[model samples]
Structure formats: structure tokens, C-alpha cells
Target: MIGVGKMKQYTNVLDKPLTKGKQEVSLSAFAFLFSELVQYNQTQVDNIGELERRLEDAGYAVGARVLELLCHRDKGNRRETRLLGILSFVHSTVWKVLFGKVADSLEKGTEHEDEYMISEKELLVNRFISIPKDMGTFNCGAFVAGIVRGVLDGAGFPAVVTAHFVPVEGQQRPRTTILIKFAEEVLHREARLG
Candidate 1:
């Protein structure tokens, strides 16, 4: 209404309730859409960083919405206030919402003071995507990292999330590790409030 002032008011089409039992979408459809999204971003960038950054930016918005919806739906509209509590929510609940399954692993950094990791075997975002040699070191999992960053940031835990491809023994597919490094201020707050 703010931008389309002269247009006649149209009935809201999204008012219908989601009465269907399962709210899942076809994986094939998701793959196609994600491929198109990657292609679109690829065309707009000249370097790998720009491409990954764009993809991450797109996911950031979705993650913001997801954080709100997940908190409202699963946490009874309450937000997690502790470090491990929030990480558990992300590793279990958020992963389940996005991939229909929990993440493979969640671990704290032994060397770092305030760092965490979420690993996924065969990340859905990279399922149908193949990185070109020219793109060198580019991984589509950055989008998922950005989503994690967005969710953590929105929940008052500012962090930097990066995705890396790790080869797992006895596993045919690569594992994607999302490294989350929380800000010093956030760590201080977590300690003070924890």
C-alpha cells in the first residue's frame, strides 16, 4: 500500500490457513530453485567472494524470518538466552526445520574461547551444485553459514560464520563445517549473564 498507492486493494491470497498435514516441499523443486539462485548470483559477480557474499546476503533475510518463526513456533515465543541453549536450538530445531533432520554434529572450539561449530554431512545447499575450477575454493554452504550468522545476530549473539569443506573418512560426500566465532562482547555478556 505504501508504494502502490493508486492501485486498487487486492484480497490477500495468503490468508488461507495451512491445513495440510505435512508442510514439506519436494527436494527436487528446492534443488532447482537453489540452482537457479546460484546461477543468478554467479552472473552478477566477477569474483568468488562477491558471489558467495551475495548468496549469503540472500540467505540472511530468510534466516531472519526463520528465526522469528521458529522461536514463535517451537519456543512458545520465547528466545533462548544462554550460549549452549541457543546453540542446541540451532543445531537441532533450526536444522530440522531447514533440512527435515538435525545437523550431524555440534561442537565447541577447544582452542578458542568463544567459538562453535555445526557440521552437516552432504549439506542440502550443495547437493546439486558443483563448484567450477575457476571459482577456486568456492562453496555454496556459505549461504547456510550466513543463515546461521543471521539467526545468531538477531538473537543478540553477534558472530562470524564461515563454511569449509572437510573430507570425512569412510564418507563419500564432503562435510560442511560452519564455524561460528562469537564477538568478544557477546562472550562477555554470555559469561556475565550465564
Candidate 2:
């Protein structure tokens, strides 16, 4: 066998310096890639709901990895434990990183103690999607919902995360709301912590 020199390894991911500024994913570029993801998933599912679910499942993995990387790299392995802290992280930190800005609103659910709502006037995924009437109201926010679930669940705050389109009184298009319902244990823990 011919003699081969050992390949030198570059700096580890943890050793790299954090980004100095926001990395912009242009709307056009993001739209193209997101459309491709939806199209690729379209072939695999029989119906719109399945397609959305698959997308959500795919996003769940991405969210889980994102949490791990951010915790280790950005936060120096510190993770948010409180409900509000994690929600703020998702609303501000995660949203800023992914969508280039903080979400429009983060509101406590009026009817429920365990629920919260994260609303965006124009969600990144919904901006790129154009579903037909026959297909029904298929909100692409499901994928984002999965991402939130993954982040919360990975951080030890298990919850049921979902997305819905709520109408805006004056706007022609509806806004997306990511609804998170915390598990019983999570609520209990929050009570204890309080």
C-alpha cells in the first residue's frame, strides 16, 4: 500500500468563535428551499395533513439539533428551565436566528393556565406556501410547531405544540399562532419552582 499522510483536523465546532452578526437568508432564497421541501414531501404523502405532519416531524429533528448546538455553542451549555424563559428563547432567540427577527407577539392564553401563544403576522413558512381551497386550511406552521416542541421537550419542558391560522380583523391574510400546551409535570414543576 502507498504511504499516505494523516489528514490534519481543523478547529472543532465548539472552538469556533460565535458569529459577529445576523446571517441573512434572503426571502427569495428561503422561499425556494422551503418550496422544495414541501414539494419533496408532497410526493410521499397521500393527503395534505400527512404532508404537514411529515414536515413537522422533519422540523422536529432540526429543532432538536438546533437546541443542542445553541446550548453548547451560544449559551455555553446553559439551558432554560422555566416556562417563560424557554418561550422567550424560542420567540426571540430562535426566531431571530431563523427568521431574521423576533416573533410579533408572545401571549399567555386567556382561557388556560398551561397554554401560551406565539403569533407571527407573516410566518416564514406561510409566506412561501400557497395551498388550494380543496386541500382545506393546511397550515405550514405545523413544522414550526414541531420545532418549538422539540426545543421545549429537549430542554425538559414537555408540551404539545401546534399551529393555527387566526384571522386578523383588518388584514386580508390570517396570522399564524403557534400554540403550546405544557404537560402536567411541567406545570407542577413550575409551581414548585415558584
Best by TM-score: 1
Candidate 1 lDDT by residue in tens digits, 1-194: 13345444548846543222355777888999999998899899998899889988888887888888888777778998888888998999888888889999999989998889999888988987777777777889989998998899899888888898888999876788999999999888878885
TM per prediction:
0.88, 0.87
Candidate 2 Cα misplacement greater than 4 A, ranges = 1-16, 20-22
- Give the Cα error of residue 189 in candidate 1, in Å: 0.5
Give stretches of model 1 more than 4 Å off. Answer: 1-21
Q: Tell me how many clashing residue pairs each candidate has.
A: 0, 0
lDDT value, residue 98 of candidate 1: 87
Tell me model 2's lDDT, rounded to 2 decimals. 0.86
Give the alpha carbon lDDT tens digit for every residue of 106-154 in model 2: 9999999999999999998888577688878788888899899889989
For residue 39, model 2's alpha carbon misses the true position, in angstroms, by 1.2
lDDT of each: 0.85, 0.86
The collision pairs in model 1 are none
